[model samples]
Target: MDELNLENEHELLNSLETILTSECNLHEYIDDIPQIFATDNLKTMSHKEETNGENIETLFDKFPMSSNVSKDNTNEIVTLKSKCEELHTQIERLTKEKEEAFEEIERLKDQILSQSTYCTSLGAVLGNLTWRASRFPQIVDTWLSNFQSKIGEFLSIVNGTFGAFVDTYRSAFPPTSNVEYQFVMGLLGIVTNISASPEGREFLITNSSGMEFVQKLIKLMPELPLAPGTVSLKRLMLMILYNVSMNKTGLQYLLESRVEDTLSHCLDDEASSEEMQLLCLRVLQSVTYDLDKPKYIHNLIATIPIEKIEIITSAKRSDISNAAKQVIKYLQHSQKITK
Candidate 1:
């Protein structure tokens, strides 16, 4: 019995060694084994071997590589996070700068708009002041002589501002609002009478600035309608033309504009009163006397309508009759020349 027992112990030890060796080659044996150790068999083992040699080999192979890969992945993730943070900061700064630039542009636009409005208002005020100042001739003369610089400054402001006002207001109001129209006429009278003065002649010779003012006023003349019996506007216009005719240079200026053409239109209606006819006749006679200049004569004769001339000659106002007869004499002379 003792001998048999020793043999059995030797066989059992050898079996145990074989099982340990098989477990150690777990990596190689994984495909061959259908099942690892059964739960009941593991519990019956004297020493607890929770993991096989195959499992140990798997742990050794995977642990170092997986740890190194995890470290690399962690570094990549940190770099991406830093880049995202930088981009977010740059976007925020750009957004703020864009907002500030937009606000500044809007502020500048508003300031420009405000300044434009103020300049227009100032221009209107200066125009009205000039109209007021022109009402007194003596004051104008004194201002022109003693304070020539002041006169120039005032005229500069007036010319600039009134030119704009006439352009704007004439479109809004009727052509014959007596108060406003009279003020314009009065200003023209001031310009004409002043140009006739010795100081004005000197100013014109030196500066040529007043000529610009007169040209602007003459351009504005179409806005004033010939309201019947309201002689103030027509009188002022004729006076300006008369002054223009007196000087050879001024005569050339007046004739070049063909103002005579406008005078014909003013006298078209036979219904025009004697006073209106007289004004028209006077303008024609004054313009035609300078017929010695071919340019002036041609424009003057072309401007006088034959029918209106006949009607004006028949209707006699003592003031207009003399002027109309002088116009007839000039026309007869012009016709002879044309023939």
Candidate 2:
């Protein structure tokens, strides 16, 4: 029994020595090892190691880092949302810019087309009229013949290019000579001649820019100096008004324009010649002749100077007296109807 006991103690010491030699290397880092099994109670050491592992797992479960991960995820989502909104705003701005660019392009295209017509076809016609002063009538006649069927189209050209020409000449410096003025006069004369015909009258009445052109002409008339040199200009303009009045539409436009007021002023002006007064009376006669509408006729009667017209009814010139008498008759009829 004693020998057996000695052998058991000797075997235990050898096992302890082997474990100590394997676990402790003094040449290596001490922090590389987590625990030292210093006791000979191996079973107790194993139990303690298991308890420590469980405590570590419990500590991690109590205070987890998942909330920081959640916050980071939320921040990332917010950043992405902001970027998306910025992209959307950029898209909207780009879309609006695209639409505006298209509108500008369309406007530019129309302007280019108008300028092209001004430089080419209509420009060529006006150039000929300006350069060829002697053949003015023939050129006008030939132009009318060639474009009579397309009067509406021709008037469109007049509205665009010829209108520009009139403005240019009217505003030109005196150093440019009287040719420009005469060119404008010639153009107005062409318009007057065009107004003489029924088809031409209708075009002037109904075409989109025709009455607008007439309005412009009337506005220009009052600005012109009605001297001996401008008598023909005034006469041509008055003749256009007279011819336009032959149609009901034309008459309405004239009455609304208060052309009677202008006529009355002309009659009252002492500087106005007998021929001008006669022409004025004739225009008044035309203006009152075709008035089936009582309101327009009434407006004319109310607007014109009745006493002045009555005084002229007994004038020396038969034509002037006759025209005054006709106007008086129309006014009397209108007054009787109103009563």
Candidate 3:
């Protein structure tokens, strides 16, 4: 029994030594923690770290210095700066592109504004003359053959009456009576109405007169800043000239005159309306209709652009739209003949 107590005492002494060694190791671990925090270069740490050192307990509570967390944050900052620079460059490029697009749009708007009147107002005049011709088919036929004597004697109005109409106008026009302009429009309207017909075209062509009256009528048209009466009279003259020019003889007659230059001068008239401009275009179409005449064809090609023509083809008025379509057709025909 004595031997058993001695062995048990020996075992108790060994267990006590083990307990003391564990206590020493724990104190060493606590002592090393502060040194690790003091030497670390982590910049995101609080002001306490920069001033002195953090509390020993707080040093362990935060992310560890050996975890590579600070390195990862540095990489993230660099990437964000690069992205900011790239975005700034993209914004500059887009601003330049937008400015260029706005300039192009302004140029296009100017082109369309110049042509808008022809597409809208000219259509009404063209439709009116066509309607009148269709309504009094027989009368137009009789008048076309004997314009001065047949219809002229009946109304006491004749082609020579246009000469007197111009005499009523002066250099200035603001105080002019608006009612007197109708007589000029009426006489010319009847002539255009008659000329627009197929049978009427035949009379103008076959009659010994053959637009001799029209050649004289063109000379009487007043120059620009035109009185209202002169403007109405000239518009009628253009319509008559356009109808006459639809034929080979009329085309030949016009090519021989300064009418092409006259039409250009009329177009340049600041006082000219869209209806006047449209009549000018119709006359141009007839004059340029002679595809066999290279001079006329070249004149047309030089005078108008394909894009401008394409824009007018969409005119809100059907007569203007149809006329534009016919103009485009003539242009295409001219192009093919040239090629």
What are the per-residue Cα lDDT tens digits for candidate 3 across 199-285?
665555455444556656555443534556456667767877887778676667666664656776665576877787678777767
Which candidate number would show the highest TM-score if scored against the true structure? 2
Could you tally the backbone clashes for each prediction?
Answer: 1, 0, 0
User: Where does the lowest 10-residue lDDT sum fall in candidate 2?
Assistant: 25-34
State in Å the error of residue 279, model 3. 2.8
Candidate 3 regions exceeding 4 Å error are 1-135, 142-157, 167-180, 205-210, 220-224, 298-339
Those runs of model 1 whose alpha carbons end farther than 4 Å from true positions after fitting are: 1-141, 174-186, 196-208, 223-235, 269-276, 305-307, 334-339
Better of 2 and 3 by lDDT: 2
> What CA root-mean-square deviation does each model show from the true structure?
23.7, 24.1, 26.4
Model 2 over residues 105-145: C-alpha lDDT tens digits?
Answer: 99999999888655555544674464354235565455556
Candidate 1 C-alpha lDDT tens digits along 1-95:
23336776676456445434544453343432223232323222212222343344444343333232335544643454354345435444655
Which of the predicted structures, 2 or 3, would earn the higher TM-score when compared with the native? 2
User: Rank order by TM-score, top first?
Assistant: 2, 1, 3
